[model samples]
Target: MIDVIGPWNRMHHQDTLEAMFRLRHQVFVEEMGWDLPLARNGRETDQFDTARTIYLVYRDEDGAVAGSMRLIPSVLPHVLGDVFPELCSGPVPRGPAIFESSRSCISRKARRKDPNGMIWGALTCGMIEYAMLRELDFITAVMDRRMVDMARVADWHLNPLGPERRIAGGGVVAVTMPIDTHALDTVRLQRGVPDPVLSLRFAGARAA
Candidate 1:
């Protein structure tokens, strides 16, 4: 299940958050070789993991962190605005209706079993659904070429903020993806999920 999170419930999921950090450490640092700060305790986190960050954590029946992603309000300091401003043609898009998404990851263990890319679809669809539910207009990010292509083929109303440029490992570009009912419908059709990817009926309680 994909669990939506906000400042209100962040402290209640310390254990899940820690597990997610560990999974991120394994995927981004150890496997992908990203030069991010490695916590002494082996969790991978940055200054961006703040109370304001909204998260969607995909966990299985046994409570394992299969995949996760986070959203930072554009009004706040975020990677696209502070670190990769050069990637875009002008000032990054910032407003109450737009948010910057980052730190998306899926555990290697989960990937090994998900050959159909269902997990990926679920995460992306859930993110879009969650954003629209919050009345957000769009979600922008600096994504690599492969991710850009995925968004393109997935039929997202993606608008490139700038041309793709050579980066450390490959090409990357800034993009703004719309979050609306039409986009959500297309994603559902593409993924063939009749119901919302998440059981988004939050009751102000811990996800079961």
Candidate 2:
């Protein structure tokens, strides 16, 4: 199940949030070696993780953080806008109805259990559901080429903002993914998830 954690309910999920940070450290720092300065003490975090950020955390049967992603309002400072502006050909897209997704990762344990990538599919579905609930228009991200390819295979309507560039020893591209019923249905159909993935507890949470 996926839990949506926002400022409205952050105090109730500190342990889960910490586990998410550690999972990020394991994936982005220990495994991928991405040179993130804020990764310290077995936690991967940065300035962007603030009160305004919304987190989607996927938990396994044992309630361990299996995968997670964060959503930051595009109107605020985000990684693509503040750190990798060169990845965009023109101005970085920003608005109340737009969000930037970052720090997406799945734990090794979950990957081992999900050989067919259903966990990733669930996370993606949850994000789309949350976007739909909040009436968001677009989601932007700076993703590695491999992830971009996966998005293509999943049939996400991705609009590239700039040409792919080699960053941190890999091809990375900036893209805007349209948020609509079509995009959500495509992922659900391809992943064999016919039901909504976001936790019902916060599924109806309004945008702050």
Candidate 3:
């Protein structure tokens, strides 16, 4: 069984950051051959990493980073609005409750029978718990095509932006998932969120 937990910005987070970089390089750069030439620092990062964000990392029993992702508030640096401005035609949503999910890649070395892998589930659950604790208004994810169906399967509130499509990693479509007031009312209906304790971090008024 994998142990799921949060990494504070202090010790655990530092290690997690390194692990995330390595995983991204391994998957996005070496194995997948998407990043072209490797980076001088051996990382696959963008402006989103430095934004107002919280990272959730999954590690093995040996404490090695297994998979990871990040959460960014829409008010700040979201991939679609802040970074990938070409995709949005109008004003980006800034609901005081919106967070954009980014950098959600797992370790390529880790094998999985599923499409997105187990880390995605743990990260989503952890983000929900964290959102409740922080009183966040909403959570969002920029959905590349490959994971759009996964979002639907997971019962997340997702939709495409229409017209413009960005495909990466072998023709995956792009979309988004927004967890606003409507989503708050039905988070439990989402798959793999049975244990309410997993949502303790993002609970309270924010969850309502």
Candidate 4:
């Protein structure tokens, strides 16, 4: 299950957090080789992973973390403030209309078939789940380039903020997802986008 984690649940999910960080290092550092100039320890983290960050994790039967993601509410603190102000001519978002989701990573080792797809679904679910819990409307983010490109043609509603560019070490772009808190977790017959969305539903949870 992909569990929504706040500071209240961090202690129970320490192992999951470790695995999440490890996977993040793998993808954002070793695999992508992003020399994050903003990193404190030369890691991929920006100013986003602070106390205001919301963590989402999916675990396996083997008790290892499978998927992970982090979110920053635009109404509160967010990356558009400290990181990429150039996304807009004036200033980045800090409104109730948007929530920034980031720090997404899936474990390298597979716990099931198509680990990447599983991670995407879990992360997407986590965003929807958070929106419902917090009574928000939109869950957006400055996404990686590939996701932005793929999302452009998806059934999911989107608003593009930036083109793909190499800013963070290699290059990544920014995009937004207009998440409906009422969005169903179950997969729909979607057409468009090369990477398909995850077929997922929260256990014991129904669509709002």
Candidate 5:
């Protein structure tokens, strides 16, 4: 199951948020060796994790956080605009209808149980579903080049914002993914998830 946590209801989901942060620390800091200052105390958080930031969390059958991703309004400070503007040859895409996706990760326990990558697919589908529900036009992200291929396999319509650059010892590129029903349906079909993933309780919350 997936949970949509936004600013308005974030206070009600403290435990879920903490689990998501711990999962991020495990995947990004301990495993990937990212030198993040906020990644202490077994929880990974950053300046971007503001009240307005929205989160999509995937919990396994045991109700443990298996995978997660964050969505920040493009108009606000984001990773591509604030930290890695050089990755984009042109101006960073910014608008009310655009959002920046970042800090996507899956927990080790989930990976061991989910050999088919259903968690990853569920997170991707949830992101697209939330975008469509919020009437977002595009979702921008700075991710490893390999993710580009994954996006293709998932049938997501992605447009590269700039050429790939060697960053943090990996090939990273900025991209903008168009949000539409076609992309959503394609991902749902590919992932074999015919039902919506976003939690109904928060899926219809007002855009932050």
Candidate 6:
């Protein structure tokens, strides 16, 4: 079985955090050919990997990082608002309720065997589950246009913030998705998860 958990306290979960970085390096730098700078130690990280970043990590039975995504508070310096302001027409959505999700990575090995798309669905559902636990309204993300169809199939309420634009990986769109029961159920069903994917444990908190 897969183990999914997060909004992990980075300070308290340093080992797991390191594993996540390594997985990101493998996915984004080695596989995707992204030009982003890697840490001298060979991990993919940036200014965004700060205290405020909340993460939802998917782990295999042995507890190795399989897939993961990072969530940043909209009010803080995030990719959608701070890095790609031109992508949105008006003010970027910012508040305690809305969060910006980015830096998603699913290991190549996992993808090779994820014929049912369960890993992707699980990560997506975990994000919504995290929002529910925190009483948040929704999540904003700069995502590849391909996800638009997945959102449709999964019954997610994705409201596009603006038109699609070409980015590093290809065409991408900004979207705001609600974190409500319908959305949650849709994601869970899509992932084949009968219940929650996120297992919460409090250590401390920070913002990205």
lDDT of 3 by residue, 97-208 (tens): 6677776766655556335344556666666666656666556555566566656665664666544464563433334555443443344445343444242333232333
Estimate the Cα RMSD of every predicted model relative to the unseen true structure. 3.0, 1.4, 4.8, 5.4, 1.5, 2.6
Model 2 lDDT tens row, 100-196: 9998999998899888888888888888888888889889999988888887877786888999999868899999988888988888888776488
**Tens digit of lDDT per residue, candidate 6, span 1-208?**
3233334445577888888899988888888888896454669999887766788888876678899989888878899998887778778899988889899889988888887878888888888777776777889988888888678766786888888999875999888988898998888777786576766634333221
> Against the true structure, candidate 6 has what lDDT?
0.79
Top candidate, metric lDDT: 2
Q: What lDDT score is found at residue 169 in candidate 6?
A: 50
Candidate 1: tens digits of C-alpha lDDT, residues 1-208:
6887778777888888888889888888888988886454678888888878888898866778899998888989898998889889987899988889899999888888887667777888888887766777789998988877876787776888988988776898999988877777777777665457765666442212
For residues 5-101, write the lDDT of model 4, one tens digit per residue: 5655466766666667777777778767767666444345666676556677766668677767787768666766566767644456567646788
Worst 10 residues of 5 by lDDT: 199-208
Name model 6 segments beyond 4 Å from true: 1-8, 38-40, 201-208
lDDT of 5 by residue, 7-90 (tens): 878999999999899999999999999999978999999999998999999888888888999999998999999999998989
Model 4, C-alpha of 151: deviation from truth (Å): 2.3
TM-score rank, highest first?
Answer: 2, 5, 1, 6, 4, 3
Question: In order, what lDDT does every prediction score?
Answer: 0.81, 0.89, 0.57, 0.60, 0.88, 0.79
Local distance difference test, candidate 4: 0.60
How much is 182 displaced in model 3, in angstroms? 9.8
Greater TM-score among 1 and 2 belongs to 2
lDDT of 1: 0.81
